[model samples]
Target: MTTASSTSSESSQERYQHALMNTFGAPKLILTRGQGARVWDEDGKEYVDLLGGIAVNALGHGHPALVKAVAEQLSTLGHISNFFASGPQIQLAEKLISLLQPASGVGSRPAKVFFTNSGTEANEAAFKLTRRTGRTHLVAMKSSFHGRTMGALALTSKEAYRAPFEPLPGDVTFVEYGDAAALAAAVTDETAAIVVEPLQGEAGVVVPPADFLAKARAIADEHGALLWLDEVQTGMGRTGAWFAHTASGATPDIVTLAKGLGGGFPIGACIGLGDAADLLQRGNHGSTFAGNPPACAAALAVIATIETEGLLERATMVGEKLRDGLAADPRVTAVTGEGLLIGVVTTVDTAKIAAAALAQGFIVNNATPDRIRLAPPLVLTDEDVAAFLAAWPTILDAAEALA
Candidate 1:
């Protein structure tokens, strides 16, 4: 049985390599099943998934609520064109608008939402919406990552991702991240918008200064540029809050979301608040299958599950435990980020560390050469954290020796 399974897995991998585009490079494991924070490979080896599909699986795999919601929605009405609306779509849009409300107790500001299939698409939609401002100039931060699509890629600071696809959308300025002065200097009256991630996730869960978002809000207000916060990774209770920028009391004009929003389902949202809400008028934007019923239902289920399961508070508690435990290791130089969105800087090569972690039945991401990022499921249990902590030293030792 084992030999047959191995042969089948290998055959399938070869078929995949031959058939699919080489964009992702290679497959790490042939995942067969998952429940909660654990997953099983084709060989039936169980591993703790600390990366959560790059922070996508908030409720984790095979979550009954998510599965049921999607199933029921599909059975009732799977999809409809953007010209028509569904109950799930309207409900999700309203839910997201309520969630995007700032926590500062300010008067309610009306917001509108545009749904998309993924984070990059959400960013692309927002990018086009910015152009509706009649100003082409935009400002983004260095080392920041918004998405990979051409429009989103234009705002991303990494040259490697941009170089191959250059002559990207122009009229964008990249300024040093976390540098308020640089941001202020870059944003001018002609700038349409300023895009930033409340916490940089792909650049290894980098958190900005406490006042960074506030300063950005002030700067955008001063320059008449829309303040766009990309919360695809840090929003939807991932950071123990509805949104990361809310913690800084910064109310952004535009917000993009995805990743964990659907608890693994493909759904993204671009929100516009206040006067910005009306910028993208009719005929300005459209998506064929953006707010299909099943996807919207799945997202609503994830949000409901998060609220009912009290995962937000749990994320904070477990995150502190993991952060403190990981930092205790002398080899771990620093720990950053809040809640489950964590990044660990190591003295050893992160690739080796990731390999060692896999050997120890753990799933983590080497987000950068020196940073190991962990965006585990919000429902991560105390037992899982304890097990990872117990094995941390051994993983490091093996990685160090391998390095």
Candidate 2:
């Protein structure tokens, strides 16, 4: 059996296909290294990264702050089991609680945090917390993406992702997103929680009505159901705010965060506010590597850097430029989203646009057949934006020709 290292003669794509599972399909590029918003392939070709690791690279690749914090924390103290908590873990938890203060508005009610290794795990923790309400029914928005885990999948609204794994846990009701009336119709007193993504990311960065979240809050309150906001993709300054729902001023009982929380490191959090905070008592849930020191330190560093560098304002500024430039093109039908999480609806198939982007030394995501989503690193420079904008017309032209 030839190991990957021993088969140096084979192309990186060939090696990847032989070694990895077929879950994500074929490898698009064999990336070797990255700096800021740019990445280099194994063959040394460079491309501007517009997708930002699917909105995970908040500070961009190889950020000094993230690197330093992880290294220092690992050298000082690494993984510690849940039996004993570390400073970084405790501090990160505190930090998250503080950030959610404005969005929670629980008054004297305290918030509690449960750490996880990924967004799905965080959502899983939140799901279990909802079960503690003594109700098995849940209401989730249509086209909403929470995660891929069994429990999280039960909350997700995509049929393609949930069909093969039928009989998912819980009795979940799906309602039309952005439709407050539909949501009200679905959620009942028996419903334990109403899970929604303030801005639907996987559904091509769909932005609901301005008052949708506030309406969801009222509806949940009317039925005595907890309001769970899944901010896995839009949280942690991805939308120019600590959480995307902050602007809506809708207080939530539960908030799940990940993606940019750890910059590029793997870390997530499940926060329960007010009465929901006490739902998951001891022994209800546990994880082996949920709050490791290195990951927590990385998260802390990411948050600190965001505040110090003013990336929230930067995300808004850069996002505006990208949206305005893209919308100016006749090929683009509409542009939606906030800050760096942008969606471009094209007149042609986005698959062609994505292929054309890659060929033209840019990385973008064809989130759907007709929509292209851009969640670039908040650190994407003016030069990088200019370069992409300069080549935008040609990329569209190539895509149009293919169409």
Candidate 3:
């Protein structure tokens, strides 16, 4: 007789293969459960989670606050659609507004927000919001990744991601990332918006110069183009702050967020601060699951946890340790990022290093051939950091020797 667990396990693989299309290839491992930065595969292999669901699991899996909020909200009020708003929806917006402070100037004004189900949807909303300005021209950075949607894909610069689905929304210009002068030249009065990721996450966490954002702001202002900051990966306390653009002292007209916003639950916000807020109106846009109760509740829980637990400060402290320790290893030559969001450059093959680390019971990711990204849960413990650091050398040795 087939045991229930055995039957369920085998059925999971068979059903997934039979029903699901080949997109991301086959699953790495059939993950059964997870908690607090650790996950057990279907085979019951325990692995320390260092990737944190590609930086989306800010609090890790099965976090009590996240679980409780989601469960309670779902039990109470699940999906009300876009016709009416819920308390969690309003409260979460107000909370985000408070987090994303408004700018003061002659035309400067408080920001407004739009909610969506994922990072790509958030970008899609922002993409449409940019059009409300009447100008259709936009300047995006080369190597930028906005989203997978048609509108967002147009703004994205990768030929590989865009070529198969051309010709994308037209009137968008691609500028060299991190080049202040190039950005200045690309953005003009006719341009509706200038979109940038303060730290390019999908491009391997590439941080621009200190003044790059400032320069973008200046150029955008000079041409009357809105400065749109896509903080999907860099915001929500990932870089030791609420927003990566905070260092520039230049407030963006638009900011889009997701990934870690709901601590694993799907939620995204497109904040239109000041005049940018006025751009999108009642008839302009909408989403059914945009700001629903359960999603908002999950997001509120995440923000509340981050604040109450002092995870922001903790992220800064522990991030420095992880970055510095990894840098000490000869294979890891450089480390870039602040707080828990880190990118490591290795002299060794990143894929081999990632596989070796996984074999050694750690979970990190090879963002590229030479870069590994670490966005462990903000709740990642100090002990995990120490354990991973200790295993770093052996992981590298195994990968190198095997190669």
Of the candidates numbered 2 and 3, which has the greater TM-score value? 2
Q: Which 10-residue window of candidate 2 scores lowest in summed lDDT?
A: 3-12
Candidate 3 displacement at residue 127 in angstroms = 0.8
Total colliding residue pairs, candidate 2: 0
lDDT to native, each model: 0.92, 0.93, 0.88
Worst 10 residues of 3 by lDDT: 102-111
In model 2, pairs of residues that clash are none
* Residue 320 in candidate 1, Cα distance off native in Å: 0.4
What TM-score against the true fold does each predicted structure earn? 0.98, 0.97, 0.95
Please report the TM-score between candidate 2 and the true structure. 0.97
Off by over 4 Å in 1: 104-106
Q: How close is each model in CA RMSD to the real structure?
A: 1.3, 2.8, 2.6
Which candidate model has the greater TM-score, 1 or 2? Answer: 1
